[model samples]
Target: MHYCKEMLLIADEMRHFEGFSGALAVSNIEYMGTPNLREKQLSEFLIYSNEKEIVEQQQILFNTLWEKAIPAKQRIKEIELGIKREFAETIRDPTEIRKLFSKLLESAEKDILSISTPNTIKRIEKLGIINQIIKAANLGIKVRLLIDSHTFNEKINDKYGGELAQIKYHKLIKSLQSFVISMIVDESLLLVIDIKDESQENFEDSIGLATFTNIRSTLDIYLSLFEKGWHQSE
Candidate 1:
C-alpha cells in the first residue's frame, strides 16, 4: 500500500518514536497553500521546542500506552484514513507505506500490541519490536506478549546457559502441540504472536522491506487468525 508524501516525510523521523512522541498539541495549526504538499507542511509547523522525552527502558513505556495510548476511536479513524489513503488516491511509491506505518504507530500509544513467532532470535531482533514494546511500557503503556510457549520451553533451555541454546531441531512434529493464550496488558495492547510453524515460508521473494505492509491492522488480523487456529486445535 502507498501513503502520500506528506504523511511519509513526517513518518520518517517518527519511526524511532524517540524524537517525536506522536503528540499533537492541536494549536498553531497551519496549512500551506500548496495543493500537494500540505501534510508535510503541517507536520513541519507543529514544532514544540520541548517535544523531547527520553526513555531508557521501553517495556514500561510501552505498557503505559496500553491504557494511555491513543483513544481507540482516534486509532480507528486513523486506520480508516490510512485505508482510504491507500485506495482512493495514487501514491508515487510503496516505500512510503513504511511512513504510514510510522504514523499508525505514532497515533497508537496504548492500543499497540505485537504478536510474533520468531524463527530465530536474530529474526526477533531484526523485527525491532522488542525495543518497541520496551519503550511503550516505559511510558506507562500496556503491552501483551503471546509467544508460542513451547518455543520458549523446548527450543530454549535457560538452564543450559548461553551457547547451548542454538541447538537446531529439524523434525518439529512434536511442535503441533503448542501453547496459546491471550494476555491483556493494562487493557491496552493485546499481542497474539504464534509459536507453531504451521504455515510454510514463502521464500520466493528476495526483497527485505517489501514484505512489510506497514499496516498494523493487517498484522492484527493475522494475529487473530493465529489465535483462531490455536483455539480450534484438539
Candidate 2:
C-alpha cells in the first residue's frame, strides 16, 4: 500500500486563488504566512492557473524553501561537528535538570563519569539517574562516580555506600571540600551544577545553577578535575 501525502507551498498565493470547496478563515493573528495544510482546499476542487509566469514564480519559491529546510539529522550532525554553537545553558528547574541528565546518559557511547556530593547523590537517586546508569552500564558503558569522603554522617554514609557498592565503580575524595557537581559523558558532554547554597541540608532545597556544554576542551578540564579528586580519594 502506498502511503504518501504531497506537500505544496501555495499558501503565499491563496489570496489570488478562486476555489470555493471550503475555506478556513483563520484569525489574522494566527496566520504565519507559511505553507499550511488548512490553506489547501479540502475537496477535490480545481484551481486553474491564471498565467504561466505566475506558475513559474510559485515553482521557484517552492524550490527555494525546500532547499532551505534542513533535515533534523543533518542539523544534529552539524551541531556534533561544531558547526553549530555549543550546548550551553543555565538550568534551575529540577525536572529540566534531571531530564538533561537522562538525555546525557542516553547520549553516552563509551563512559559516564561524575563528581557529586553525598546529598547530591541522594537527589539523583530521587531522580532515578542511577537506574539509567545501570542500564547504560549493562550495555558495556563504563560508569564512575566520585564523591567527597565527608558526604554524610557515619550512619547515613554507610547506608548510602552500601547501596552504591552494588554498582561497578566509585571513589571517595579525601578532602573533597567542594560542594559542586559535575557529570561528563563520553568526554563530549559536560554538566556542571554549582550548589553554593549548601546551608540547606537537602539537595533539593539547595538552590543550584547548572551549566551544560558539549565542547571537548571544556569537558577535558572537568575530567582533569575529576582525575585529581579520584586520585586524592584513593
Candidate 3:
C-alpha cells in the first residue's frame, strides 16, 4: 500500500512540474499534459539550473545515492525484517532496474512520444532512440516524435563538427520546441533516458530513466530532471 501510494505521488509530481507548451503528440491543442508553469516563473525545487550541470550533477547524485539515502546494509536489514522500503537502497542487483527499463521500451505498443528541445547534443540524443521507436511503431503500434525550436545549420556552427554533430536523427517534425510540449498524452508511460556518453559507438550508455508500467504511477523526479535539462539547453 505504501509503495503504491508513493508511486502515485511521484507521478503527480512529474505531471505538475514540467510546463510543456501544448499537446504535441497526443493531447488537444489547448491542454498540455506537462502543465504551463515556467521554471523562471514558478518557485520549485531545482536540482540543476543549467544544462552544463548534467554531467557533474548526475555523476555526483548517482555515485552517492546509497550514502545520501538509507545505506545498503540498512536497506537489506529492513527487507530482511519484512519492513516495506519503497526503494531498495542496495544495488543488490541491477536486474530490477534493467527489467523496468526494458518494459518501458516494450510498452510503446500503444502510444509512444519522444519530445525534445532541438539542439546538437539533445537532438542527437533523440536520434539514437527514434529508430528503435519507429521499429516498434511499424509493428502495428503508434509512434510519434517531436523536436521543437530547431532553427538552422548555422545555429550549431561547424566548430562543433557542424551537421555531423547536429543532424543525428533521420526523421522528425522539427518546429518551435515550445509548441511541441503539449502533444504528449495517451502515453500510459514515458521514458526519459539521458545518454551521457554522447558517443555514437557506445550508445548503450544510459544516464538515467523514468521507467513505469503506468504513467500514472511513475516518479515525477524524472520529468523534473527532463525539464531541468530542457530549460538548461535553451
Candidate 4:
C-alpha cells in the first residue's frame, strides 16, 4: 500500500513540476484493468546500486532529461506574464484561424473584447463562435463586442439580436471603417486578420495572413484601440 501510494503521489507532483519527467520501471510487474495496489506480490523493489554499468547508463539518461526540462517555477512565471512561446503562433489558413479562435474563446478565464465587421460576424457565427460566446457569458465571463455597423441592418442585427443583452457590453460603430477582424481574450491573447474585400464569394478565401500573440506591447496597443473605439461607439 505504501509503495503504490508513493507512485501515485509522484505522478501528482509531476503534473505541477515541469523540471522532471519520471517513470517507474518494475520488472515482470503485470496488471489488468485497474491495478490492485494492495497485492503483496508487488513488494519487491528494484535497486541497481552495485551494478555499475546499469547505474552509469541511467545517470546519463537522467542528466539528458534534466538539461531539457524547464523548471516548474519558471514555467509558472511565463504563464503569468503571458510569455509562452506557443502564444505567438501565426495562422494563415481560414479553417485553422477559426478553429484557433474557438479554442482561445473556450480557454478564456476572465473576459473577451472583439472588433468585427459584418462579414467577420457572419463567419464567426457560422463557425460556432456565437455559441461559445454565449457559453462564456453564462459562465460569468465578460464579453464586449464593437461592430463596424452604421445601422441595425439584418446582416448584423438578426443573428446577434438574441444575445445582445446577454453579453456584458456591445456597441455599433457604423462610422468606423476597417477591414481587420480582431479578438482579444482576457486582455492577454490577441488575434488579428486582414480582409481584402468583404464581398468575396467565400469568407475564408478573402482572408489574408494573420498572427496571434500574447506579447505585452502588442496587447496594450489593441486594448487601447478597443477602449477608444468602444467609448466612441453607440
Candidate 5:
C-alpha cells in the first residue's frame, strides 16, 4: 500500500483543481497583476494513470493496508509510554550471558534471588558481578544467594562473607546441591545458566546453555524452587 505523506497532500490538493476526475492532469492559475497585465502560476502536479487493471490493483492494496492499520491514537500512546513486551530466549555466548546478568542485577528494584554452585559463584565474582549484587544490597534491595553447601569453604567466605554481613538486606544460604546458576530479579525476569564443566575456572569456559525470560509461569516455578532451597538451607 502507498502510505506516504506526499500522496495524502497530493490527494487534498487535487480536490481544488477544476474539472477534477479520477484521471490526473496539470493545471495553472492566472491572476490580475495590474490594470492591463496578468500573471500565471503553475500549480503542483502529480502524475497518474487511469488503466483499469492498475486502478483495481491499487484499490486492493489500499484496502489491505487500511484493514491492517491501527488507530493513530493507540500508536501515539504506545510511543509515549514504554512498550512492555515479554520474551524468552536461549543465549549460548558466555560473554553475552555475563553482560545480561550484570544488567539485570543493576536493574533490580525490590529483590534479587539467586542459586548457584560455589564454583559458579566464584566465576561470577571474577566477572565483577558480585559488585553489582553488593550495590543492590546497599540500596536496600533484598538480595538472596543460595550456594551448594557441600562446596562452601573459607575462600568463598573470605571473599564475600565479611562484605555481605554489613548489608542488612543481603542473605546467603548453603543448600545441598545446585546444578545451575539461576537468578530472578524483581520477580519479573529470570536468567538461568547451566554449568557445563565445573573443572574449568573461567566463567565463559565453564558455562553451557543459558536461558532468559520474563514469563510469569516460569518465574513462579523458579521462585518456588528457590524458596524451598532457602528453607532447607535454614
Candidate 6:
C-alpha cells in the first residue's frame, strides 16, 4: 500500500529526509478500533500530541532513542551489502561462554588457533569442548594449539594423544602463570577466558570472565600475538 498523500508531502518537503532526524515527537502504539472507527483501525498507530507534557515526554524518549540509533544511510547500506554487525561481549556465565565457544567452533570454515594453559585445557576437556575441537580438526579444519611446556606431561599426552594427532599443528611453549584460554576462529572471531582460580577443577568455578569479539582491530592485535607465540613455540 502507498503512503498517505500528507505523509508523502511531508517527507518530500522536510529538510531531514529521515523521520528520526526531525524535532517532531512521534509515539507508536497498538490500537483496537470500534466499529465506528473501523477505517482508522491499525495494528500499530503513530500519535502526535499537542499537549506540552506529552510532547516533552515523547521528546525525551525520542532523544534517548536518537542517541542509540545509527545513521539511517549506514543501516541501509549494511542491509544492502549483508554486513554482520560488529560486537564485543563479555560473558560471565560459564554455560553461555561454553555455548558461544561451541557455536564458533562449529561455524569455523578455515582455521582455529588457540593458546591455552594446561589447567584451562583440562577444564574445557571435561566440558566436552576438546571433543568439539577434535571434531573440527577431523573435518579438515586447520587446528593449531599452543600449550605451556611445564604442564604438558604424560597425563595430558595420554588423554589427548589420539585427539592431538588429528589436529594440524600443536606446540609447547614455556610455562605461563596466567590461567587463560584464548581461541581465534577463522581469523574472525576471538574468545578469551580468564581463569580466576586455577585450583578449581571445574570450568565454571575456574573461569573469571570470558570475552568474545569479532572486531577487526581487536582480532588483528591478538592475531599478531598468536603468530609471534606460534612461531616461537616448540
Compute each candidate's TM-score over C-alphas: 0.30, 0.56, 0.30, 0.59, 0.60, 0.69
Q: Mind giving the per-residue lDDT tens digits that candidate 4 earns over 1-234?
A: 344345555664322324332342322232112223234455333343335565556566556665655554455556778876434657778888767878989999999998887677666666667788888998889988887454324554576776655675445465554888888999989999888778764667768877899988999998998888788764
Candidate 6 colliding pairs? none
The TM-score between candidate 5 and the true structure equals: 0.60
Candidate 1 local lDDT, 169-206, one digit each (tens): 22222343343222223233332222333342321111
Q: Best to worst by TM-score, what's the order?
A: 6, 5, 4, 2, 3, 1
The Cα local distance difference test for each model comes to 0.37, 0.63, 0.39, 0.69, 0.68, 0.71
Angstrom error at residue 155, model 5? 1.7
Candidate 3: RMSD to truth:
21.0
- Whole-model alpha-carbon lDDT for candidate 3: 0.39
Model 2 spans with C-alpha error above 4 angstroms: 1-85, 149-176, 199-203
Q: Judged by lDDT relative to the true structure, which candidate is superior, 1 or 2?
A: 2
How many backbone clashes does every candidate have? Answer: 32, 0, 12, 2, 0, 0
Ranking by lDDT: 6, 4, 5, 2, 3, 1
Residue 105 error, candidate 1, Å: 5.2
For residues 145-184, write the lDDT of model 3, one tens digit per residue.
4444342233333323432332222233323233122222
Error of 1 at 18 (Å): 27
Candidate 5, residue 15: how far the Cα is off, in Å: 36
Highest TM-score scorer: 6
As for lDDT, the candidate ahead, 1 or 6, is 6
User: Scored by Cα lDDT, where does model 2 land?
Assistant: 0.63
Give Cα distance to truth, residue 222, candidate 1, Å.
4.1
